[model samples]
Target: MLLAALIGAAGAVGAAPAAEPNTQVPAGSRHYAASGFPDRIVASPAQDAGSGFAVAWRTAPLAQPPLLELAVAGDSPDMGQVQQLRASSQALQTENGDSQHHRVLIDGLQADTLYAYRVQGQGSWSAWQHFRTAAAAGEPLTVLYFGDTQNKNLSHVSRVIRQGWQSAPDARLTLFAGDLVSGGDGEDDNEWGEWFAAGGWLLPGMAVAPAAGNHEYFEEFEDTPQERRVLGKHWPVTFALPSNGAAATASTTYWFDYQGLRVVVLDGTSALDLGTAKAQASWLEKVLEDSAQAWNIVVVHQPLYPLRAERDSSVLASEIRPVLQRHKVDLVLQGHDHTYGRRADDGASLPQYISSVAGPKQYRLSPQARATMKPTAEDTQLFQVLRLDDKGLRYEARTATGRLYDAFQISRDAQGGKRFSEVTEGRIPQRDCPRPVSPKGRDDRCWE
Candidate 1:
């Protein structure tokens, strides 16, 4: 196992219990509170290709009038020459406290140029950070993909993300397939705080493209009786995503273009609504039809094909699968199953679908789950790296310690047909929960 693989999940099974699922404010969470310093800084893709990018951060409630300073860097940038812009801000109230979230969209940037920028609170400014804009088409790229990072966020889950970044430092963008936090309704600010802490500086350095998982949506108040789950209130203030998706889904359901790849994110939670489902399905088909990128990828929270033995998202699958099939999406990545699974489309020429988890939470595999998923794993946390080359795309799933657990390659032909092949080299055997020392933990085992 690689050193990185030794860090989380596999090793954390014996650690202290994770935060309560409904904990909006874990004990001692005051230590994690935001001060005058800017935190939870994140970079997201601008609407278009290379012309722009967006950055967002949170500050103390007393902090007002968010500001962003940016400068184009050549051999070196002169800090004094930086241009300043007032960012748009929104007020949010969470269990942690009241604070303002700010986002600034820097436009008219030269493509492929290095730029330095920083944010400011009421009286403090963050250290300068730098990022490179996307280049034109045909540039080879590597993208890091992570599944549901929804538990033990600060201590354990953060390592999973850091290890992934350490392994693929040059990756252009990071795709988080949702369930970013355990409880998304802002009931638990600690989960969000931990999530932000886990990323540290990496969150602002690399652009994050995230999907909305079930955890990202919750009943507004934990005490609400028979309340329908909705997109968490924090989502709008937390992420500044493209607004090119369905009107109902907006930021949570959006798409962006990087180099030659077009990535579309959909809200699986909304699919439960018949009206919204049809609208998203229609919008998806239109987006696919309009896309000119060489690659099209779809990301959603619930797997169209569930990986659990007793669970299935057939309604969502029925609504979206046809659109995916008609569009010939290259890949479909998902979360919410809390297990690892991969299945090719029925025709084998359609999208290659996969679902995985990346937090300390673990689930067992049943005979039905085993029978449905060809390559599946239980009680394991994993991260995947995908490299897009001239010929095709190569994917590898590795443990936190850097052990290779699963891999495959998708090759595209001159006729636009995709050929999927599993790369068995360096792949580790599927993992099952080990026998526990305590009889009370038997239910957690992946194997009987």
Candidate 2:
């Protein structure tokens, strides 16, 4: 069923003609282009919270079977005993060239343990990277979150991701609210490579949870009657996610429990525009209802309350918000507005909504955002660090240069009611585009 959904999502966009071997490669991106050596390695959490995890990577078609070497990290530099596990590979043909993607799933490990692993390239092996499994339930945990990195991933957004890691080096999981790349058509392999290069070793060291953005879906053939939006080819092979989501959405929409937090990822692009809203909503209700973790948070690409006045995600607002409100979700991390807006929960029922951007792209804040969000910003690239524990949740937003831009805290009462408060002592001044004196060309004043 998973395979079928993946294929369907890819094929639904439109079949592509065979690629010409002479496709032009973008400048400065050749260093990241796929080769015989392993690249784009990513680590993801398995369904078994504390016991297992998965890793995926890309390389040219291998002449020999791929292998993954794993061992428990110890004080000794030498890996005393290593377990060699065979990996499965699938051939993927993109505009850049033909490459093979490999994935290995490791299970039956001890809980809350640190493990070091490396993958076999063509003739050599990659440097060993380390990742720790989720701690036991109800333990303190830290997480790093980012909004859309849809453009300038290599040159600009790279700093934001590295700064995020520097800010929370011990963070267990890194969550991306989608639009990781700008290419809507599935064939833009260079953009994907730049994205991986931007993350470097951090992607493999921390578990990743990603949601799908609309930019991840595009029409293969534009302006034709047969044109239909479909999922990108790089998505399925880039990250190995848990398959415990709605059947229709498969790997793109899923959830995993990490150290007392139930992090649910939804496919807003698939749900709102692709006719899977009801399925996702139903599955979400069940997931929220059955969550046994101390807190529940959702990650989606599209914001329920959009930051740009011209944008409207009415389907998501109507179909998904009710379920979240009914379940009393703690927080929602979102992207797609290319701006920053954070709204705390009202006295009544809405969960805290935050829309942010990590890439160079920016947009103007809408009137709704100006009125509701306390400290909205435009033309700013930001990253967030979220720490959750028995005491409460602490969230801090920082600029690309690693300055504190915004801070907030959420504390829960004995009855599980949440109270939100802002930390404005050391935060930088709020940034917004100045209104143009001449209204004729006002649209060109801010990032649009």
Candidate 3:
């Protein structure tokens, strides 16, 4: 495994766990505390085509406004023609402390070009970091897809993300199926800190496309008659996503195109329980109808067909499924079931559904999973790498230890029809929990 090799060679150290979920922040804990140096820097796709993108970062409150220095990457240490741009800042109060989040949307750049940028600290400038723009049309694209990293983020999920990045170092974008953190209240800044620390320096370069999960929303005023659910406070400051989605949930739902592929992200938690189903459904139909890309993919937190019986959502099946079917989206990536489940294309339809988890949390598979899902697993963490080229779209799912778990390819024929074929020759055996010989403790199931 990449992680094992790196650790053995470098004697790397793991991140210390942050504060427990929804707990009080301990005194003198610098794990999540904001400092003068910038941190949690991330890049996101802009609403426009491949010409522009957005970058965001956080730091301790600054007396003077922050600035961003940008320049086209060149061979020498001396950066020529550097452009210093002012960034917009937002003051935020969190349990970790008061901090400022800054964002800049850079535009009018050459396609398929690399650029270096750095942000101003309190009295110093940050180290130069580099990011590449989306390639021109018809260029092959590679992307990494990850399921819920909601628990044990720093301790366990860190290795999964690192291994995925090592496996696909040139991937342009990373799609996160949500429930990114265990706490929904959004007040636990430490959880967000853990998530950022888990991704480390890798987050600043690659573009991120994330969907909001139910855990991103939490009930306010608990035990009161006026209690209500609201999205976490950290989301807006953390991600500078496109605002071209449905009116009701525009902040969490959006779309971006890279090369010949278009990625559409949705807020399933808001649609199912926040009275935005009709609005999202209407917007989804319009987006799909207007899409011009060769390949289209939809990302949402809840699955249309869940692996566990209790986790099923009828609203998703009714509202989202029809739009996907009508538009013939190539793939639908989902999470929130805490297991791995996939339904390959049936040859007549276009989309194939996949739901997976990347954290340590596990849940028992539904009884029908064995009959319905060709390959399924419980108590396993996996990440997927997807490559899109002229021949077709190739997808491979690998375990946290870098072993190939599942793989398939979706290709188009001369008649423009799609076909699905699995790589069955060298795939490892399907992972499933062993049936217990006798009941023990309070439950008979293998998962708690």
In the predicted model 2, the residue pairs found to clash are none
What is each predicted model's overall lDDT from 0 to 1?
0.79, 0.84, 0.83
- Name every residue pair that clashes in candidate 3: none
Candidate 1 residue runs with Cα over 4 Å from true position: 1-28, 62-64, 74-77, 184-187, 220-226, 273-275, 436-448
Name the runs in model 2 displaced over 4 angstroms. Answer: 1-30, 184-187, 344-346, 413-415, 434-448
Q: Write the per-residue lDDT of candidate 2 for residues 1-448, one digit (tens) a residue.
A: 9988987876754444222121234544444456878888999998766988999998988986699999999888899899999988888887667889999989898889999999988887888999899988768899999999987687778999999988888898999999998884433687788788788888999998889898888875679877767998778888888879899899689998888889999999888777898899999999999997778999999998888887878999888999998988888999999889988556653478989999876778888879988678988889999998866888899999888999888887767667867788889998886544212344632542
Clashes of each: 9, 0, 0
Over 267-376, each residue of candidate 3 has an lDDT whose tens digit, in order, gives: 99898887788889899999889887778999999988788766657898888888998888999999999889888445544578899988866666797766778789
Tens-place lDDT per residue, model 1, 1-448, is 5755875644565563333343334555575566788888999887575777889898877535778999876564456578898988888877767788899888898887778889998788888888778777668888999998887777667778888988888887889999898774444577788788887877887778899877777765557665677777778888777767798777678888887788989888778732478888888998899988878889888888887666667777788998898888988999888888888766565587889888877666667668767688887888999988556888898888878998888887777677878899888887876645212344643321
For candidate 1, what is the lDDT?
0.79
Native-to-model Cα distance after best TM-score fit, residue 436 in candidate 1, in Å: 6.7
The per-residue C-alpha lDDT of model 3 at residue 423 equals 74
| Per-prediction TM-score to the true structure, in the order listed | 0.90, 0.89, 0.90
TM-score of 3: 0.90
